[model samples]
Target: MTHDSTGLRRLLLVVADGVRHDVLADEMDAGRTPALAALRARGSFHAVTSSFPSGTGPAYVPFLMGRHPARVGLPGLRWYDRARSLSWAPAQARSYAGIDIWHVDGDVHADVPTLLDLARPSLAGMSMLGRGAKHGRIGRSVAWMLRAAPSHFRGDLLGWRRVEQQATGAFLSRFAAVRPKVSVLAITSPDKFAHAYGSDSAPVRAAIGDLDAAVAQAQAIAVRDGWRDALHVWVVGDHGHAPVSQHDDLHGWLEAEGLRVLAHPRLHVRDPDVALMVGGNAMAHLYLSPGERTRRWWPTHAARWGATLDALLARPSVDLVATASSATTVEVRHATRGAAVVQRRESPTGPRWSYLTTTGDPLELGDSLHDLDAGTAWEATSATPYPDALVQLSWLATAPRAGDLIVSASPDWDLRARFEPVSHVSTHGALLRPQMLVPLLVDLPVTRPPHRTADVVPSALDLLGISCTTDFDGRSFLRGTPVSAAG
Candidate 1:
């Protein structure tokens, strides 16, 4: 595609949630998604493996910025900040006393340049459509720009198809009359359908069909309006989904293990023995503490607790174990601060576990147990000896502080203390391949192609003819080569 400075290519990014590659291929072969299949025939389509801990927020941010979660400082869906002594969940930022956690400096904006930033003067508009509460931040950012300049404005917050139809109709109506240099549209019906139903559910299939029709309609609008040559339509997804039979209630399990719940007086008044940390689909954090502890009883208690945890892992619901020693890196922040903790181990036998260490700590540093106050500093680490073993156990291991141990369970097994008959029927966030590997499909109208997620940024920059000075870990895949494509 040839372009001028003012007529540079218009990129449209459509995100479908939890749509897997295999599922798409199966659908295509069965003649389910005609629009997507047609696009594939004209260009190319393949499954691009997403980032680890393959959840929505972690996956999509990288695709937009062309970087990894770690590089963007969005390590996972939820992150615990040692300095701030707080646990940050992008999904729940709206509930955080009016604090917009998504805009926090290091979370989503560290090294990433959004498509809006890249489009610059040539950029006509950008839009994001999705269901999560976190998506509000994206809408807010777009609103901020629109308020600054009414003419340089085009955006939408069409969360679902109902809203999407209205918003898209408005966008197309306006753009068709006064065509801008570029206009971006994001459709999210496919992902929403997959989450409520399974990947193969009839409803999900119908949603995909609807989305395909939407794509066709949008393409037709572009073509008729003389914008087809300038428009580059791309369909992508944050992550794919798998059927989940079990879910782990980390909070309930911790409470049963004799941990004392702390109360954040300002946040909530209830005396919570364990804080149930929430992330998208799967994975949670458990913070615990006990009223009293001394150096004399620490080691014996830690070892005994670790053994009990290992025994618990032998259950069908349990899949892996990462002792404080195995899972994370620990660093003591201060003399008064506690020792760091990290530990993890995969289950080798039946109910085999794949213990992948997560990138963030799960506890909030400062909180109160009963009437006693405790340091908020903490870490995730292995169960090895430390210079100050007592402090390390207190900070990292769930046992020393809460009289309970934190456990990470597999998707098949629901970890609950009471073993309720009714719980979550479906879950995600295990260390399994299905849960960890997400799909990415990028359709760029160019001779050169990129294979890996890391390559996406440089490739995008190259498409825009921008200076490639950023030291991205991903390299661009050479164009016009079969091996360079994603599959």
Candidate 2:
């Protein structure tokens, strides 16, 4: 990574997966995490919303490439392309469960450039989305471990912590030799523990302590390896987790309703009319059709799925359902709360968006919102229960990889109940606040931290005086200036 002329010599980012804002905040407030507390003392730390789906795959887009999850067209970790599956190809559906994880780098938009590309001589230690990193890639072997342990409290927790240790160890041993300009280390124990235990459980809290140890080690190593004063560190989370107890058998419920479902472990169904894929158990994608294998253009025909939608919302675990109303609009429905529609349009100022409620407030934003430009829309929904839902949902509603009918599970419940060896006690991958809210710990002080996680990369690039041609949805808020929207 060639930096023109900057005071900072290297940019280091750490992602502690599945960390909740309140939990970490309490950790820092209680003086338990000396390293994080020290970072906060030197820098600024604030709660920010992760992108939609809140799963590791789509959620990583923002931090890696400075693009919204929807803009890249891969909405979730699992997706079924009706256009590809319904035709002779019949191979577009996948769950990226174990060995298939490598396909993610290939599926993202080819034109988009990741930090590994823009910031060369970079290292992705367990940062899974290391498409362009040349030094070394860690954590890909974690997939092999998952096949053995299957991601549970018994063995995978230790394995994930080992991955964290190995990543940090690599930084310690290799930094002096390689001297990578940009390095991103992913600490995965918190996420794994959160999945096995509750988000606020004792085990997950201990995982946070372990993260502190990792941070302390990284700090000492960075200073020792010629980055004492010329290093910028940003510690963040890919997504947050919410506690879960009840499981909604979304796929089973479809099969019981006389629809053929395509599920994992068993990838095919004869003459399938429904394809159900899940992300973090809290969010589900249901592509429903009458044996036509259709996923596109379902938003305009929401009436055809009225009975199914009613039954799903009536299901105890379901929260809200979203569908593409059009290319730039989304139709949303809650079980008992109400219904709403989010729309996008062109305006004199710039492209504007709107959220109007024909019935009750499904999103509970209170009143109907009129035309709002991008910045206002972001500011308006930044604090809602569904953070950034206005623009996030609009972009997701039209995403090619998204479902015709998307479901977000209610609190304390998840959508996957069967066909899995392991069950999660706490999960993310929903539009809810706890799942979407993540902590952004960065050294840069700003009047307002960009509420979106996608802003991190562009902001980092701006810090190092590096420029890229990719049009990022995330804006850089650094050097006391806003990242020009059109730039």
Best by lDDT: 2
Global lDDT of each candidate: 0.43, 0.76
Candidate 2 CA-lDDT value: 0.76
Quick one: RMSD of model 2?
3.9
The digit string of per-residue lDDT tens for model 2 on 1-487 reads 1222454457778887888988998898999899888878866888888888888877888999888876875788677776563222234575555555666777777788888888878887766577888787665655534533444324456655665666567655665567677888777778877887777877778888877886787667766875655566788888989989898888888889988788665565687777788978799888776245445576455667778888998988888899886788888889777889898997675577889998889988988899987678888887788988887888887887778888888999998887544568898888999999998887646645677888898888877678687777777767464323112
Specify the poorest-scoring 10-residue window by lDDT in model 1: 373-382
TM-score of each: 0.62, 0.91
Q: Residue 260, candidate 2: how far off, in angstroms?
A: 0.4
TM-score of model 1 relative to the true fold?
0.62
Model 1 per-residue lDDT at 139: 27
